[model samples]
Target: MEKTTSLISKKHYPILDGLRGVAAIMVVAFHIFEAHATSHLNQIINHGYLAVDFFFLLSGFVISYAYDDRWSKMTVTDFFKIRLIRLQPMVIMGMIIGAVCFYFQDSVLWPTIHEVPIWKMLVVMIIGFTLIPVSLSMDIRGWQEMHPLNGPGWSLFFEYIGNILYALFVRKFSNTALAILVFLSGCLLIHLAVTSPNGDVIGGWSLEPTQLHIGFSRLLFPFFGGLLLHRIVKLTTINNGFFWASLLTVIVLAMPRIGGSKHLWMNGLYDSLSIIIIFPLIVFLGASGEVTGKYSTKICKFLGDISYPIYITHYPLIYIYTGWAVGSKPSFQEALPFALLTLIGAILLAYTCLKLYDEPVRLWLKQKMLTYKPAFITVK
Candidate 1:
């Protein structure tokens, strides 16, 4: 006789969830600040882009914790199904939101926005639904972003790559081999950060060779390093881990650019060190933490829930805000109220999608796709 088995749901690290929410909020602030600043060096929330790196670290750790031991029962197809159910609903909603708001974002900043036809925009939106990046030749926004409809979708593109890599090969590696790969990737990241003319790990949105290098460099080390960290380091209990970890996250992401224009490498060093050292520490702390009270637990739950929705959905609004700022040429003080409104509006919209669209769709997908019948084998 054979027995049927069901996969057990994994426990979540609430502190990590809370930290993710904190980082997501900072990303919104970073983009909002991007409208006022002329360049990377002068931008407020200077290191906010590093939130993406921090996210990758979190993703690797979470994925490992969730799936590493399940391969005995989980097929690759099942793994992809779970990821898609968890992630794709929001991605589709983000593209639809982008397409809906595309024309309204027309401004002198994006000169060709007015010239692009509706059908072309729809084509881009449809492509975006699939998350296969469009080449610059097809770019409608003039930003050369992989997904013109949703610019930040570029990171999701790399995110898919990471997932594929993990499912296919990295999942099978020994801890020692994994550590070697992580070390080499770390070197590449440091080299890219220090040597780039911009002096940061910022350029992963485009299709060009240089940008591709930056994208992979941004993706590899922290992701695999997080995996390595999971395999090697044992978790320890910590008091108030969420508060300290969140404080460190905010400080690292909000710090001023180091070295200025003359010593760009200093900022590069900061980026490298933050990714290679500080981000892992934050994850470790978060993983080791416990959500102590009802208030704290609820706060963590709310933030964690909205983190991805807000990050994926807010940029379309930012496009509109950027257009208004550029065409009106408003001072920072003049733009302040609108910026606050934009931030508030984004949070509201994200929450609405979470409740009305993402949750329902994901639930439906899980019911439809994930309800696989158990397979039984002959007893020995």
Candidate 2:
């Protein structure tokens, strides 16, 4: 039999770490250039916001692939405990950091906060602090449940939801049905994002919990897309890394056409294309072992490791940095330096926090959490 490359074949792939590095940098470029055209040449960096969608698509596949089987076989308490360890500790630290920044800065997080009350603020804070996904939106004395401090934080809630749903349903249905549900979710999200006519999403202003009604609908697709892709590729043993690499290259080259004519068609095409391409490339590079090479991967893995913290904390920093640079006019000579400094600064801060909270918390949780059931436990 011909040897086939499989992400499933390996337990750890550093190239995915490298890919994480790339994806994180793409987001940094996208945000660094926010709304300001550096030059027509700068569009590549500017348009990198697509990276976040790519991250979501990738996350859907990765987190699910990593956790699904574990959840399926483990006891409920074990399942929740593993998830808590995997995600919550660092996430809560991020929330605390964000809250501190919000309190100190008194500025908006992503220009999303219009009016948030003390009670609603308490709820969002408490939910974030406790790491629960609360889309149960309500008006308590005219206050609303919203995600105020960090816009990216809400995605974690949906992530946890996806994990639970997969664990519950994966054992009961055929793969086909699961695929259909996930694909439909992606379609619904695209429809909602574009259908507004004005292009403003439902919670355009803030990362409000209410935004998640549609947002959850939107994220469902990518998460499922990733998970399904992993299962299929692993089962079929599709090993042609070149095929995926070429596809991603072409997609990146063709990105110039994104957000243009045939808007919906083009948008969906690239979005889907990215996921298909990036994940395999990730697997391939990991198998190749190039990601561990001297100098580059070292820095990249470091960046990748710290990505979550930087992502959560950078928004406040960006707002402040941009606001400060507003008067400086920030010429081309200064742009690169400023951007580099901002990115580096965010990375360092994240690294410190990761050491303080992320790693220790993950270790403790893994050691203490319940694990997947071995075959002996089930009478299969």
Candidate 3:
């Protein structure tokens, strides 16, 4: 297989971008359905948590493709600035959205929501905007999530760690060295996933030591594996790229929970194999295919545009929906209409933030902070 020098030189992979959007949508669905169930065993979208792994893989591949060759021209500060520009705006918006929806989310699970002062929530939201994880004592919400305002912010925190590691260390490693790192991370991931009492790799939101282990275990392998895949794989031209890639992505994400409760390792094997093997295939096919029709191209572009915004912002609403569902214990048939409405509301809210807040904030930041010209890198 021939190796390519830079993702900077290649055209944007529209299908991969769309696949991200698809995965983001699936996450929203998963969270909605998650509200209706007591545990992963009964959750409708049992495998939806794997979407975070998918996001890490996609981020790694894109980072490698875009920056692997530009490190010589780019300083570490510039790279950090670029990443912050791309990500922090959404971080801020997600937190603000969470804060705005926080009071409305009061329920039995978060009974103290009524007692926590507004200034405290604002303080939490302000800290959250910086992408800093708070300790449990400062946790305004009772959930103990590192970012109580927006639970999904934990992934972004790890993503920042990955970026720092890439800038300071990983980028310097040879392919063999990087492969060893990925291998070790994969082993850790498999062990963590299999051994967890829940029979899945889903417990990374809290601030405890064990949850920290889960967070890193989830982040390292797929992110570095993606970087490795970009370094090694030959991209073949493929047809109906978005359709097939999205279909496979949905299948993997929606796959029934493996091994059930009796055999936890069985599910762990499923998680590890999917990340190690299947995800890279999806990225390859997505990168190799083109958006053929005008309508398809538009759809992919829209999906790609909203993917990050949706993922980051939708969970606060999930907190609200979860509170409502837990209080009512509504049947799926009864909840379906409101669930559909929640999905629509989340999308509309994401689009609104994208246009009104995120886009303009990023544009202004780029003008003020991006002193060095970024080498062309397509962001999904």
Distance from true location, Cα of 69 in model 1, Å: 0.5
Clashing pairs in 1: none
- Please write out the lDDT profile of model 1 over residues 1-380, one tens digit for every residue: 33334765566688888899999999999999998888888999999999999999989888888778878888898878878877888888999999888866667877454689888999999999989999888798889899998999998888888899999999999998999999999999999999989899998999899999999999999888888888888999999999999999999999999999999999999999999999999999998989989999999888898999999999999999988988898988899999999999999999999999988997788667764322221000
Error of 3 at 86 (Å): 0.4
C-alpha RMSD in Å of predicted model 2 compared with the true structure: 7.7
> On residues 229-301, what C-alpha lDDT tens digit does candidate 3 reach at each position?
9999999889898999999999998888787778878888888888888999999999999898999999998
Candidate 3, poorest ten consecutive residues by summed lDDT: 1-10
Q: Write the per-residue lDDT of candidate 2 for residues 46-88, one digit (tens) a residue.
A: 3354454455556655654565565334555655665666667
Error of 1 at 77 (Å): 0.5
Give residue 327's error in model 2 in angstroms.
6.2
TM-score of each: 0.96, 0.71, 0.96
Stronger candidate by lDDT (1 vs 3) = 3
Off by over 4 Å in 1: 1-5, 112-114, 372-380
Model 3 — TM-score against the truth?
Answer: 0.96
- Number of clashing pairs, model 3? 0
